[model samples]
Target: MVSRTGLYPGTFDPLTNGHLDIISRALKLVDTLYIGVAINRDKGPLFSLEQRVEMVEAETKALSDGSNSVIKVVPFDTLLMSFAEELKADIIIRGLRAVADFEYEFQMVGMNSFLNDEIETVFLMADPHHQAIASKLVKEIARLKGDITSFVPADVASRLNEKFGN
Candidate 1:
């Protein structure tokens, strides 16, 4: 049988629960899932490229356990389509948390389609529990010493606290 590869790209400055949820859900949809860690300097990530990649790998490692699909963590600093093409991805998975995000993502889908219509982009709405979780918001809450345990994984929460010396 042929296999489908899905690419889920994000900066993941600090991998959040929402991201993991998407990863878990995405695994069910593809034979291989590539967690594309993007090097977006404009976002001014708190974590380094290597750090983000390592965290993503560590966090996603367990998601593939007992599953036939493979999950690879890759770091990229180019156009999203270029990275997707390189991986020969059959689909690009994107997590949408709210209606506000749809407008922007809608435009992105169009632009990406123009670049490569063959590679499809799939949108997965964040689970109800994770609908409010955003990496940026998580970072802010952590910086203020708020309880971010619910929004991020234990390891990531620890790292965020350490970053703010909490």
Candidate 2:
């Protein structure tokens, strides 16, 4: 039987609990999951690629245990569909937070389907508590010396604090 693998791609500038929630839920639908960190040059990410990868690796280490053990955190600089094709991922997992997100994700799903007909996209609704949490907002709040402990992981919070010299 073919191994079922899913690709969850995102910038993940600083991994957050909402992201963790999505990752945890995505694992249940596929035998293996690749959390792809997008290396988008245009975004001017606050964290370096290496730092983002390390943070994701550290955060997901606990999920790499047990019989199913097939979680991978990797960096992808190419198009998401190309990365999914290269990794032989059968599905692309995305998290939907609100109606605005739905509209954008809808267009993306259509484009992704057009790029690779065989691969499917799966959308998971964010948990109610996480519905309003976004990485951009988290970063802004953190930059302004606001409390971001509730939005991201402790390690990420520490990193943000250190980055902002808080």
Candidate 3:
């Protein structure tokens, strides 16, 4: 409760239900949450930046009904911590699902802390049901013509299928 604002940045090629869980949990811990949609061309995102932003907006519409419905979606070029600073956010909310993610996030947290000593990073473990769902895995499964209906929201799954020609 110390920090009222948080920045939650991610590729969100197409927002999934797992991402929804993280956003929902982070909402409880902060007054405002900035869901940053970073457009990294090097990543070769499945969806365009505008499409990703639209999906993120749709997925977060429920938050608009909350008392602190202060979630905003924005595009970022790079440097996540720099984006946080620009948003004047005091905390960065990260979603961690498995042990493998810990290593990468840990290093990033340390680097972000070094960049902005006053900014804090908080990691939220994904819900047990969604611990295995990730954007990469979802894409891989779609490419293989596997069912990922459970891994993402309905709209996202449809978009993924269409994008991958499944």
Candidate 4:
């Protein structure tokens, strides 16, 4: 009786292992998970959208189990609720790592609910191991030539090393 499909929207400037944890957990909560890669240039990224998409695809290869596990990467250029509606997602999945994150996401949830009454957003707390992981932190570490092996997946770590390493 699995009948839910969810849209997880994020910039994912550089897909991290933390991001994968959210995706992996969300897969069990929904039949299909659409990983919406928001194209936001306001915050510059170490990797391009194409590179991020490839990294996401590569990291998610083992999770897609044909029927139940499905990860579709799509670029979102507009409002998240609009993208969710466009995808016909029954739910919107978000990850919450701290109270500060909740403050921001709460506003988004309110705005999204106003936009579409039928759609709901679910927030999953980041695993304790990944509580401090984020794209911003990852970028900063990479900029300093610091090891980010623990922050991102192996594939992502490799890509970051290639791009940021001299």
Candidate 5:
């Protein structure tokens, strides 16, 4: 039997509960999951790539339940489909939080299909509890001294607090 691999790529500026939800759910569908931390120098991310990767690695380390699947956090600075092909990922997992996100993601799916016809894209609806949580919004709230403990994981909240000196 061949093992299936899935790629979940994103900025993950600060890993949020919503991101973790997608990761947890994606794990069930593949034999291996790679959380690709996109290195977009244009976005001016709040956290460094290394920091974001560390946070994701720290947070997802426990999800590797011997028999289930393994989760790897990696940094990539290239077209997502190219990265997917490099990893030999069978599916590209994306999380949709709202209709607004769909419009953009739908376009991306079409473009990626043109780039790699063999790789498939999978969309997972955000859990209701995490629907409103976004890394950008969380950063803004944290910047304004708002409590973002509920939106992200404990380790992520701590890192954000440290980053903002809050």
Candidate 6:
């Protein structure tokens, strides 16, 4: 049996619940799920790459334990498709929360398809309950002392609060 591997790439600047939702769902679709923590210096991430990777691993621990699939959190400093190619992934998982996301991701799919026709891009719609949760907005809410408990996990919320000195 050919094992299916997938790469889910994102900055994951604090690892929100929405990301966790996608990770949990992605596990069911592939034999191995690689959570690619992108080292995007342009985003000016709130958490360092190590921190992001650690947070992903920590949060997904339960998911990994419960599922039959293997889950690995890896940091990447290269282009997304290049990293996927490096992992020899069969698919790239993306989560779409809204039409706005679709517009961007649709373009990405087209470009990535051109990059590697062998690797497929799969889109998972965000659960409606988590549709509005975004890492950047979560950070902004945390910075302003707004409730972020719903947007992130408890550990992530605490980390965000600590980062904001809240």
| lDDT (Cα, tens digit) per residue for candidate 1, span 22-45 | 999999999999999999999999
Tell me which residue pairs clash in candidate 6. none
Q: Model 4 reaches what TM-score against the true structure?
A: 0.94
Give TM-scores for every candidate, taking all chains together and pairing residue i with residue i: 0.98, 0.96, 0.94, 0.94, 0.97, 0.98
Candidate structures ordered by lDDT, highest first: 1, 6, 5, 2, 3, 4
lDDT of 6 by residue, 91-147 (tens): 999999999999999999999899989999999999999999999999999999999
> lDDT by residue for model 5 over 75-110, one digit each (tens)?
999989989999999999999999999999999999
Runs in model 4 with CA error above 4 Å?
none
Q: Which stretches of candidate 1 lie over 4 Å from their true place?
A: none
TM-score of 6: 0.98
The models' CA-based lDDT, in order, is 0.94, 0.92, 0.89, 0.86, 0.93, 0.94
Q: Which of the two candidates, 3 or 4, achieves a greater lDDT against the reference? A: 3
Measured on C-alpha atoms, candidate 3 has an lDDT of 0.89
> Cα deviation in Å at residue 149, candidate 6?
0.6
> How does candidate 6 score on lDDT?
0.94
Return whichever of 2 and 3 wins on lDDT. 2
How much lDDT does candidate 4 score?
Answer: 0.86
Worst 10 residues of 5 by lDDT: 58-67
